[model samples]
Target: MKVMRLPGLAFILLLQGCNISAPAPGPDFPTSEMADIVFYNGTVITMNEDYPEGQAIAIKGKKILGVGTSLQALATANRTTQLIDLKGKTIMPGIVDAHTHVFNDRDRFGLDLPGAQELLFKNGITSLGNLFCTEEFVAEMRAFEPLLKVKTSLFLTKTFPCGEIQDSWYHGYPATRTPGEVLRINGIKITADGGTCGGMAVSEEFIPGTTGLGDLWHTQDEINAMVLEADKAGYQVAIHAIGDRAIEQAQNAIAYALDGRPNVLRHRIEHNSAIRPDLIPRYSEFGIIPVIFGWKKICDFYPRSPFYEAADFPYRTLIDYDPDLPVAWHGDDPYRGPVNPFIELHSMVTRTEVSETGALCTPPSWLAAQTIPVQTALKLMTLNAAYSLFRDDETGSLQTGKYADLIVLSANPLTIDPQDIHGIEVQLTMANGEIVYRLPASGL
Candidate 1:
């Protein structure tokens, strides 16, 4: 199997942003046209504003031919078409785990990407972006590509593409001049600050008065040089900045990179937990994406450092800025957290930890100011993530001519009570128009 590069197809699709205009197909039910697969009798949430809601989807090979009414999809089918009755199930684009970590020890971690992919199918994840990895992981991903059921992209740890530099002031960019690591290496990741929850998330504000601004890995000048060199060498950059002040440093580096050059492939800020409300506008002005993580686990009602006075994960600010601000959400798990994306999504929408018995696990009014609507949260799970990777056109939503990567859920997250959203089960998951995982028919 060939080693695919990072975000090979999805990056091209990101250029379209949130706009694509197309007229609806003429009213027709069961026209007898040929299709490889036709899913009907289901609620199709395309996530695309042009066609916000759909009834069915028709697929020919890996790509989707059309998304419309159940009768319309059925009409496009023929004798060879694999007609699947969803039985009023809710179908939406597969969840995209935008930020993730597979291993703590990058040198040696015999993790199973194939098995991980299967389990993700059960969770309705058909696309994943591995924000932390090494060259070894790249080779392993290529070896496992034959067994993978989901589309993926990976970013090499800072050390993978370039090792430590001699001069403490000079940034050591990757040796590759043309960014040979395009598909295999999504970008180079660097830590501008530390953690947010009492950890080392470098910031100007200290905890009350103790003066613990966490730690800064590199000076702003050093970061600027590093990003500039990488941009010239042709690799995108992702900087980990949890604190508001740290986010500023990351933004400066991205701005330096874009000086006189175009930002075609998106540069990102990782784990932007304490996003300064003022910097929120810069995200749109600078064309920078945010790969959000840990919001589901900690931001709900946890003890964040008292140094920060604003909303912790200002997702609402990002969404309100552009509605398509390249803000992608993730768990950053298997490295620092759990692998449950839905659990994260649940926490994201509800902003509270609910127990298995459907009880609230935390205080009710802890972080209400940061709560966003379910509609915006769904984009965080799908299209925004795809846009972050520049793959929105290929797989994020149920758009005409897009990949048929979708999932069927037991309940719709939109209409159901927000408290019950996490409990919704994934009845089926499909990638590239092929059924990758399906619940037992009896259970369905």
Candidate 2:
């Protein structure tokens, strides 16, 4: 080889000519943003419209960092990051049971508050709406808020047992809409009528066996005044209405509160078990949320109910009328045993009783027509329910910047037969980026 070495300056000039330069004393390579925990190798049903499905998700502090594939999520993992291999299992946003009287479980059934919360976590519920809160209950929850894992939204009641007006216990607690809080007082609750006691306030006569039309706990004017007062005080109002007459009254009261215009307060009609077709459109027109019982069609109360002739639990009718209407679900725990969302999902999907023998307790044809799909049932339990609580932006779905409230399942509910959905187990549950519940190490 010929001895032809160029000088440093000449070499630099040559490199420049080749479109190359000393990687200009570049800035230091930054550290990769790491996740506190990364769940990979599993199906992820992110209810988020932008990222509807994924195979993995990454969590930072208390919120989701990202949701995509295993490689994408794992890219953010460091040595200290807890990498959970789902191993063909499934992950989705945690269940948000919009309504349940679990405090009644504590007082009436002797289930301690912590135990009730554990039960809720085990069932994959990350958030819940405790529909009936008295002053005593509010104080208990305030004391327990620090230790709370499942997010709580309490609706203070003006009446006990859903009837008989008492002092304004709700006046003690302010309506709270702060996102990511463990506990919040969402609104006030009232009963327009009674369902199980043959006082559901029906326009028509009850079935031949029952004596007369159902009873209304409060007259239309009285309910309107109460709802208006609550609305004025910046609190959403939840009214229990089961018969056509009660449903109509509830719609009217909500309309009166909103001055016949739609608003975002999401005032709700709890139960809404029986509604005439004429009243269904009002729910959408007035921005009224129908928090109907998910398993009512198959429950003991539905088949033997006195209210007839009215469209009972007309879920399909309501949804078909307004696809965008927010229809949430409630179990009304303690009154309904097993208080499990999966059972409710199964019932809503199949419109049948939760029978132990697997024999179908077929509902009436009209009731069967109300059956919704599994996806809609899930949304009713999670996102739509969150909307009812005004928490949809905070924790309903697995979206970036939202609380890391999610659950792991043994199987995919979407892939399984609808009848078998209730059997799906919550292998693990994460609330606010912390593991609140997990299956035993032995896989029991």
Return the top candidate by lDDT: 2
State candidate 2's TM-score.
Answer: 0.88
- lDDT string for model 2 (1-444, tens) is 111221332244335442112221112111255789988767888887666777778899898888876655655666588877776688989999888877545766567888888888888999899987878778889898888988889898875554688766577678989888888989998888876454777776645655467778887888888888889888989888888888899889899889856676889998887687788888888888999787763534334343453377788778889889989888888676676788788888888767544455778777778888888888998999989999999988887788999999978988898878878888899999998899896142
Hey, what RMSD does candidate 2 come out at?
A: 9.6
Q: Estimate each model's TM-score.
A: 0.82, 0.88
Worst 10 residues of 1 by lDDT: 1-10
Pairs of colliding residues, candidate 2: none
* Model 1 CA deviation exceeding 4 Å by range: 1-33, 103-111, 159-184, 196-198, 204-206, 209-211, 260-262, 298-307, 335-337, 355-359, 363-366, 441-444
Query: Which candidate achieves the best TM-score against the true structure?
Result: 2
Model 2 lDDT, residue 255, Cα: 90
Cα lDDT tens digits for candidate 1, 270-311: 888777667888887888888886234443333555434454
Report the C-alpha displacement of residue 340, candidate 2, in angstroms. 0.9
For all predictions, the C-alpha RMSD in Å is: 9.3, 9.6
